[model samples]
Target chain A: MNTTSKTCLLLEDYLDGQLSKPDKDSFTAHLAECDACREQVRVSEKVRELFNQHPQTGLSDDADLRVRMALRREQYGKEPAKDVMNLEETAAWLGVTPGALAERLDEIPAFEIGGRIRFSRKRLEKWIEMKDGDILLQLQQSHLRKDNNLLQFPGGKHGKQQSGNSGAV
Target chain B: MTFSDEELMVMFAAGTMAAFDMLYERYRHRLFRFARSCLISVSAAEDAVQDVFMRVIRSATQYRPGYSFKSWVFQIAANCIRDIGRVERKMICRNSHNDTSGLEIDDRSFHVRRIVAANELDQYLKVLEPDERMLLILREYEGLKTETLADITGTSPGNIRVRLHRIRQKLAAGRSAVDREGEI
Candidate 1:
């Protein structure tokens, strides 16, 4: 069916209603003789219908209201003075489950206000710095371990020099 | 008479809240649907739509004339969702595999079952490259024109058509990416 033909390429445009009248006419004529193109267009139409028919389940009615309220806050409320965050937002920001965050309560500087766990942004920034320090330390330790491993290898620097001198000979 | 999207954007930039409202009405549902395709949860998609509109409101003055407002907002949406994907580690949080708890012995139920196969929808999206899937969603569901798509992706309209053609070919072939790779 010459799926790679120029006419077949136009089939996408035809299905998308992007073709001009004359081009559409010619493509329709060509479709009469092309089962592959016909089937391709049919499947694509079905796919388009499938996508248009539903919306990945459905959005709640408050979805729009929430967005509008957020936009209003952005437009009118100015920036939020977010010095503190609740448990869920903090856990989400830390990229961990709330239960996991709870496990690390001693490690983190968290407090409770109105009997709910809260995290200070400043303390979290300090925590991030500590995490970065630990990561850098681990990386340095790994590099040192690699160097020591190289030193203990049978063909280390001394053997390499000897091999180089022999290769020169 | 309806104002053009560009005009409405310019008006909003000039501090016309009504114009911003007009733009919101135009895009709220459409953008949510687009975000829903790439995100894991309905709430996440709703959050993404909010993020997109907030960015638009905050940066309205930066929108210049001759720039397609549709493309500009969609570009922001793409970036916003991609960042969220990174933060969330992009999990596939499906309710269940083959969950048909609400079916009935009727034509309407039959159609609902056929149409609302979320797993099948996931497979359809999973086979394509992420960028290809984004382009398809923007084209078909968001109903962006080829020109605006080209503007969003910074390519020529002809190139956009070619890309969409290739994507269509992939869909019609119904071959998994692994199968296509094995061909090579």
Candidate 2:
């Protein structure tokens, strides 16, 4: 009996002992008659054995300690803020509605303390570092300026006009 | 009798140093071997296993019950190996020059054959990507179930099964390709 490509892939799983008993029996029955699949299974088993025989390699003592220390520091670094500001206060600060501020919570990392969710002051400060606006609009403006510069003709002598119009910042 | 992995982890979480030590002993060799296969560097593998143990120590307090400790530890080791692979991508390049010819094997003929087999297998394993190698290590070496693999990898069990199937196919192809090249 001829086997499809999917069935052949299934045969690989069967040989790996990953198939259920019924599937295994079916696969074995098929393997009993199928020369190509049997060969594939043979090759797969040898590969598994070869992989098992390979020895393990390890990292250095110092570096291992460093990574562990780093992870621990990350986990225990910041104490959850106790006096979390209410949604109204946060929305007022951002100049957005409480619903809009709530939507942005997914973008900003926060932790819960005493059933009240709170954002780290440091994290909020970092968020403030970025210029605010639709990101695509900023990207489009930058792209247009770059194109206008590259497309400028030699000795067009429109320097004052270009600078006056382009110097929006 | 030895405690199960779950029991050991629970004990470790409760700050039992002995339980942590026993868990380390139980899985140290296996974890070392798993990392070594993924990173293909002895020092890197050692470092990865140590990092995993340290993470285990620090996160013992955060360990949730009803999860497989083996999968958790193996995932940590896998992540460490990935970081090493990213940093040392050039250093860990596979070549016959840096192959297992350095292992000192002065024993009987059978022992020598086993060592050679091991060496060949290591060279073959260097072909797989780090993620593929980790999956193979978890399933083949650690004997983890699909559910455990899913939890560790953060993928659905069905996806893990499919990925495992593909990984086995890739390894099988790698082995056969080496055999065809007369490298076996």
Candidate 3:
């Protein structure tokens, strides 16, 4: 079959009973004359059945708790404060000097409980990933792309930049 | 009355923690399963899903009304997985190659072996590229409509359909290869 026919055959709407009645009728007629497309549809249906047969593995309770706790931290700017750790211990777990951590303490996500500060391992890991070098590079590249796009499309709603004072000669 | 996913997202954007919780509860399992199926690593999947939720939290204010919340969420997840791939450069986790123990098939009968071979679903899927894996899982496992899959992956529906078809052929071939290996 041609590429267009192959792509058309992959449309799940006909096999899935999702197409409009008229569209479905046309598709059914088309399928009746096409053995290769029929086999393609059959295999796709089998793939769906195979997927349905497997049980969905869920997050463990601990993982769920960690996610919830992390959300709570994001929501409140700090968690309700459980398993509070001292600054040194937190730094130790993070493999950083307490002094270095202190310098960037505000950058780290932390919680204050009982007039003492602490950190959750989950939050710390997130904080680390947020500061991760790879993530930083990705963000940098994204910003660079956005900047390039902006530069390319100068003078949309943002008004054109006056290059060399536009007739200043 | 329980709110719909979109309603919950509106509430979540308004800083309603309960709405966020409800949304998480509703999608966590399916999202985790999709991520796990795509990444084939339990920890990586969990991290990817967590990052997806975090991005949703961060981008709540930018959400528009026209899009389906389900599609939006899965799009965030697809983007997250892609970003993970770009950063890590290694799509599958190291352990994915090592977890072949459970994939062994019996030499019983060809029919039985075919059934057992089919059961090694993950192994079969591993042959496809990351995008292909995402397309297959989203369509077959998550039962997402073609339009929504297109929206999530930012591809034309026709292209997504073609990719899904290609993935199906690849998976079938992978399974057949496994069956041949078993025969030997």
Provide the overall lDDT of each model, using Cα atoms, as 2-decimal numbers.
0.66, 0.59, 0.64
TM-scores of the candidates in the order shown: 0.62, 0.57, 0.62
Residue-level lDDT of model 1, residues A66-153, one tens digit each, is: 4544565566445353577654345435433333455557777898766666789788888779787563344323322222222211
What CA root-mean-square deviation does each model show from the true structure? 20.6, 20.9, 15.8
Candidates 1 and 2, the one with greater DockQ: 1
lDDT digits (tens) for residues A108-145 of candidate 2? 55676665666565655566665353532333233222
**TM-score for model 3?**
0.62
Model 2 over residues B1-184: C-alpha lDDT tens digits? 8589889889867854446656765776677667665664566666777678777877888888978887788778777778887876776565563364334334566456656776666666667776786787777666677778898899987788677656656666786788788964
Q: How well does candidate 3 score on lDDT at residue B35?
A: 75
DockQ of each: 0.12, 0.09, 0.15
Q: lDDT tens string, model 3, B1-184?
A: 7589998888878866556767887888888878766664456677887898898888989888556999999999998877776655464354544343322233546435444444556566668887887877788778888889988878898788777777777776787788799999
Off by over 4 Å in 2: A1-24, A33-40, A52-169, B97-115, B172-184
| Model 3 misplacement above 4 A | A1-10, A20-29, A78-169, B85-119, B172-184
Record all residue pairs in model 1 with backbone atoms less than 3 Å apart, i.e. clashing: none
Give the CA lDDT, 0 to 100, for residue A44 in model 3. 78
Worst 10 residues of 1 chain A by lDDT: A146-155
lDDT of candidate model 3 versus the reference: 0.64
Q: List the candidate numbers ranked by DockQ, top first.
A: 3, 1, 2
